[model samples]
Target: MPDFSKLYDDLKRARDEIKLKIHLGSKDAQDEWAELERRWATFENKAELERSAKDVSDAVKILGSELKDAFQRVRKAL
Candidate 1:
């Protein structure tokens, strides 16, 4: 099974970095956020291929929910 804990950590770190950049009004923060989006997309896509279809679907659902929450925090920080 995919290590969701690790994924969650990565997401958190990305969000933290994004918030820091936004707080500092750095242009590089935009680039960092874009990179985070790309990483998240790639990880989600690969997670879909590493298990049974049902498992993959469930994982995606969980990840999506977690990401939504993370994004909310990011928005608040902005």
Candidate 2:
């Protein structure tokens, strides 16, 4: 699974950074941020299992990648 702890930490850092800037972004970005937050929660739960099992599920990988990309888009929007 390539040590998803690193991936989780990196994503958490990015998400935190964006959260501080989101207030200054547009309504659309804020809405997207909200949706991403939901996904993040879902990811967090599955990520732990995957991290522990050392077996990366396709769903978690896709969701994590999606969150990363979405966070980048929101940051650019901001």
Candidate 3:
């Protein structure tokens, strides 16, 4: 089982940084940020960002991947 602590930590940090950058970003980024925030609560709970892959459900792993990609897109937008 792969450890996701680092993956989660990196993305979470990026998420925070992007949040601050949102004010300087466009309306589209803001809208995406809102949606990401909504989804983030659920993602955060399901993904403590420390548990191993075997400890987490496949659904969560998938969500994490999605969030990673979504966050990257948001970063590009900013």
Sorted on TM-score, highest at the top, how do the candidates line up? Answer: 2, 3, 1
All candidates: TM-score: 0.38, 0.61, 0.56
Clash number for each model? 0, 0, 0
- Order the candidates by lDDT, highest first: 2, 3, 1
lDDT string for model 1 (10-74, tens) is 87687777666575666676777678678877876766565557676999999999999999999
Candidate 2 clash figure, as a count = 0
Scored by Cα lDDT, where does model 1 land? 0.75
How far in Å is the alpha carbon of 25 misplaced in model 2? 0.7
Task: Return the lDDT, model 3, position 53.
Answer: 50
What candidate 3 gets wrong by more than 4 Å, as runs, is 49-78
Against the unseen true structure, what C-alpha lDDT does each candidate score? 0.75, 0.90, 0.82
Which pairs of residues clash in candidate 3, taking residues 3 or more apart in a chain or in different chains? none
Residue by residue across 23-46, what tens digits does model 2's lDDT show? 999999999999999999999999
Query: What digit string (tens of lDDT, one per residue) describes model 3 on residues 23-77?
Result: 9988998899999999988888778553545456777889999999999999999
* Better candidate by TM-score, 1 or 2: 2
